[model samples]
Target: MTGSGFRERYLDVLASIYLYNEHRGYTSLDRVLDAVRQRCPDDAEFQAEIAKHRADEEKHYRMFRRWFERQGRMPLQVDSGVGHIDRFIQWVFRCSIEELDTSEIVGSEDDFERLCRVIMLTEQRGYAQVEIILKNRLIMSDPVMKRIFQIVHKDEPDHFLPYQRWLERQGRATAKWNERAADWCIHKILMLAKLPALFLDAGRPRLQRWPDEDDAITAH
Candidate 1:
């Protein structure tokens, strides 16, 4: 492929990946919100913050969906394999998001604390990534994509603050060294292995529908 061809493919794959992750993020936050509501029923402030965070995630997801719509093409099909929070939860809880027992985590202080740490780390990693992408030449080449990422860059910092503040209120460390190490390793593995594989596979299948299609149906 020519250099321009390669760059186009790279942006498509990158945006698809971002779209998938954003969808996964808001959906996963549903579970986290559930846990927070149950565990901190009286903490209205915290619940409101989490609600806003979830809303921001959904907004970002829609922005990427609109970007794909403008291109008149579906995003590439992607699953939890490239999802940062999916891998992080699996690593920490030894279970997939579907298998996670929110009740169990909320029932134990230690478990809830660990969950907060995982979330904080994941959000921090996401913020850091958006920082890099905002400056990326390839991402900047597409004005719409660049604008989507710019919004994400603006909202990214606040995404982790609620969890970090909760941990601080509990007098617990925000993130352990090992968890940070795991986050670094997971990012490397996705960037080095999974992403390159997607970029090289020119015939990769695309999603049949938007990730939020089902939610839209239910909302109606």
Candidate 2:
């Protein structure tokens, strides 16, 4: 492929990976929501906010998948070995996704808020990343990619603000620590884990090809 063609395909692959991660994220967030319910079953507002968050995630996953379908292709299999939040949890808590769910990662209310901070910060970072893509004239030149990120950008604040509001209500002094933890997990460790995959995938042949052509109609 030509250099520009490779660049376009690379961006397409990134979009597919983003879609895959959104699916992964919502699944993980569902687990988090379950834990939240266990911790505060009676907090109607928290419950409602999380329900909306869950719905938005599911919607975003569908949006990306549909975008792939519109291109007459299936999404690339995401590199799940190292996702942002997953790696963060593994590094900080030393547990796999399955273990993170089964184990009581939060012993007290403070710990629960800490977990919330991690997710809130993740969404905040997600918004920024999407914003960067949207602002890039070259990337946004593609109407489909632009529209997808635009939708995602709109939903990010919903994911973030509710958590921030909840944290504000707590009147706790843990903000700085939580921010630091988020940076460590998302910016430092997870990025490190993803670096190899980025380098390895570069210039790969037909990186965005459909995995199974016959299943396109039923793929979701």
Candidate 3:
């Protein structure tokens, strides 16, 4: 393949892996929503927000399915490997929310700040990694995949900010040092586990030529 063609093909593989992780959300987020709801069992607003996030995650999964189906089959695997990561992050979020719930009673803002720190680390901090992959055009080449990344990357920054504002408003953003080690250690491990999937199936040889739209119809 020509250099540009090789680049596009390699990127296409990376895009496939990214889409797999994104689509895996259907199951992963279901667990997260259930856990979050359990954490805030009596809060109707919390339940409502969890429902909304689940809806968004479903839409994202569907979008990925549409694009992915056009290229090939999916594994239908129950464990996308990122499930552990998602659950841990949700657990952390739940901890913060739970802490925020009690903050009004004792006027302690520490949990709220920790929550923002986790959010900033996971969301805004995530961009540092994604930007490296996305900017390397050779790592994700399909037009549809490119569009998806651009759309997602555009919204990434905005999602990471609210928790910080929430912390400042609640007067918590400092580190507690003594209690911070365990969560941070776990977060690091989950993140490291999640990052490798991006590099899989890179440049595997095609077993067959791209199918024509009419070919699919005729076969059907």
- The 10-residue segment of model 1 with minimum total lDDT is 210-219
What C-alpha lDDT values do all the predictions have? 0.91, 0.70, 0.48
Put down candidate 2 lDDT per residue, 119-197, tens digits, no spaces.
Answer: 7777877888788878888778778878888888988899988788888878754356746665655665445545445
* Predicted structure 1: lDDT: 0.91
lDDT of 3 by residue, 9-114 (tens): 5445444444444544334445544544454467565455545544554555555556656757542222334433344444554432223243232233444345
Model 2 residue 95 lDDT score: 78
> Which prediction has more favorable lDDT, 1 or 2?
1
| Candidate 1, superposed: residue stretches over 4 Å from native | 216-220
Which number leads on TM-score? Answer: 1
List the candidates ranked by lDDT, beginning with the highest: 1, 2, 3
TM-score of each: 0.96, 0.80, 0.52
Please list the Cα RMSD from the true structure of every candidate, rounded to 1 decimal place. 1.3, 4.5, 9.4
Candidate 3, 5: how far from true, in Å? Answer: 11
lDDT of 1 by residue, 113-216 (tens): 99999989999999998899988998798999999989998998778999999999989999999999999999999999999999988789999988788778
Pick by TM-score: 1 or 2, better one: 1
Q: After superposition, how far is residue 100 of candidate 3 from its true place, in Å?
A: 16
lDDT score of residue 208 within candidate 2: 58
Q: Choose the strongest candidate by lDDT.
A: 1
